[model samples]
Target: MPQLPEDMVLPEGFVPSQAPQPPAEPRDSATVALVRDTDGGPEVFLLRRVLGMAFAGGMTVFPGGGVDKRDADTSVAWAGPTPAWWARAFGCSAELARALVCAAVRETFEEAGVLLAGPDADSVVADATPYADARQELVERKLSLAEFLTEAGLVLRADLLRPLGNWVTPPEEPRRYDTRFFLAALPTGQRADGSTTEADHAAWQRPQDAIADWAARRSGLMPPTWVTLSQLAEHRSVRELLAAERQITKITPRVVRRNGNLHVALPGDADYPEAS
Candidate 1:
């Protein structure tokens, strides 16, 4: 790893000062932890994004990504909470926050094959496989989030998502996301099985087990990911974790390079594992 200039600091995001505008570009993202109650404790879904992807490649992550422009539409029916409450949840403008949560739910549906919506979650997901396929195309700009949500008869469960954390990639990484993390219980009858193309594999694992694997170097986790999962392991139940989120007053994370590793410093001084 190369050492950063002692006096130089990188911007939080990248922008080409001079280049043709891209027809489509990556926006900041919102992601979530699909948690479920287990006798052992709260388990969360995890996916290993394909190594070929530009960002966070080959790493285990909770399902999530950037806000889609179509997510801004106010018409997306939400079953859980009001938009104002959602705004406060994600700590952004009401419109932007609503979009982030909506995108989170939508992305979860797209990536994990689980819907936090519909009258019957199991049936909704079963019926949604085709739309889910379309949402995947949205990533490639073949379709839009608005079209996917409307045509599929799916409601974006913005209320179900509880803001948990926010992180941005370090300066050195070419790809970055000012990502907001949300937490929600796994919708009943819906399971999180990831697509093999974008993700190598997926599973629902206890947060502690996930962290322990990372700490033991058994599972690959970047620094930010390591700490986030560790913090999630503190609570023994999903209800308790949800309660804890209500008391959260901050989600600012610091990106840095140390000891040959990129790190995301969270509140209380925890960090995700970065490469050396």
Candidate 2:
């Protein structure tokens, strides 16, 4: 089990899945994380949630959020592994896992405009221009990820998502995420331009530098953001990092804290915890 955090308070009205529900629609959320190798080392993309928003408002976060209902639809083409594989990894039904991956890809595009799915330039799905417009519509709820893939003849590229961590909010928190943060190198031909809707500002910083900025109070980062950055700081290179990832057979979300400060433990580590 991941260790726990001490005090984690996001903006109000953003309740955790643990919050009281009327015996319906329990436990629904997921997250996608993109960690890249930069001059500052492994820098993870961080987005600052819009202040006064529904959830985690003003908190700096990885590009992810609650899974959409459209995530479970399976009519779309899959670029890689089947939903069944992701299902086991998430401890959920295959349908749910498929949906989570779809949300991850979709949210990554919606929030950051970074397209992680699709074929390499030389592959058949050569043009990404069409998907750009489709992505805009998907964000507008005019289409689902599955429908977009089906219509565009694209694939979900499930293999592109690497199992990172599974985090459930503390039972006491009002809003929680059974979030599975997946890791991926920035895909070719895609840019990490963050949208202003969810984030006030976005940046790809050296994980260490970001942490330093947080510690120095230069950049506003919440505990979760700090913890994730600390973990990313350990990887010196993308190749050396992804090479280590192949050895990752299991990921258990543990919250680590020292002197009341909280953090999340990486898959191959037991260093920090995220929740109480």
Candidate 3:
């Protein structure tokens, strides 16, 4: 059985329970792990949520958020794999698949200042700086992704994204999310910046280096982020990593009490405990 890292600490006020009085329903969300090729390996973009935030505060994570209702609007132009294809890949409805892809692209731009879209089907935006105003509006929710794309005369390049995994937040948490993880390579002529209010810091780091930081207590990483980085560390280049085939599966880690302390157990652990 895999053991929770010795450095792992339960959230403040967290108490192991068989079940909450009522478990919060997981909200549909999406996250994108943006990577760029480097001499050492692929370096992934990460954002450290501001400490004052409610969820995953002070933890490094990818750029993403809950799906917006407007994300499902079919009026938004798209190029690449159809929604039906994404639905099959993620084991979700076509409508939700469309929303997830849109959310992924939208959130990446809103949070990282990196747009995974293009003026047309054949190319990606070389620079995102020109859309600063729209990006902020998108962050403020004043403009929906569909509206922004439509007004900008751009298409959501669904082909630029690849499904990484699906993870459901455990039932013990007050806030939960059914999150689909997506992998996207940093476009050639664009740069990622940490301008989002949610994050206090942003940087690009090799997966292994980030893991080391977590191990040395220099940074905080939630389980999902750690696991994703570990998986990413196995590949040497962005192209190789993106080309690797993945089998999408839902993984829900469980929290349990052991010797008066809380611990997390992955699905295949020797004696995985259920919170509900």
Best by lDDT: 3
Q: Output candidate 2 Cα RMSD.
A: 5.3
Displacement of the residue 163 alpha carbon in candidate 3, Å: 0.3
Clashes of 1: 8
Q: What is the lDDT of residue 106 in candidate 3?
A: 92
Judged by lDDT against the true structure, how good is candidate 3? 0.90
Question: Model 3, 53-89: lDDT tens per residue?
Answer: 8788899999999999989999989999999999999
Flag regions of model 2 displaced more than 4 Å: 1-26, 119-130, 245-276
Off by over 4 Å in 1: 1-26, 120-141, 247-276
Instruction: Between candidates 1 and 3, name the one with more favorable TM-score.
Output: 3
TM per candidate comes to 0.76, 0.77, 0.95
Those runs of model 3 whose alpha carbons end farther than 4 Å from true positions after fitting are 1-6, 15-18, 274-276
lDDT of 1 by residue, 1-276 (tens): 112223222233422333223313335788888899999999999998888687766779988877877778777756677778766765668888778877887778778877766643223343445555675776676766666667767666555667787666543343556777788887666667786467888998998898767656566775556657877888899888877844334333445555644444444443432431
lDDT tens digits, residues 1-276, model 2?
222233342333333334354322335665666777666567678888888985667767888867888788868677766788877766778888888888888888788777655643223333355567887897789988887777766666776677666655543444445567677777766667786477888988777777667656565665445555666667797666555542223233344444544444444454534432
lDDT of each: 0.68, 0.65, 0.90
lDDT-wise, the better of 1 and 3 is 3
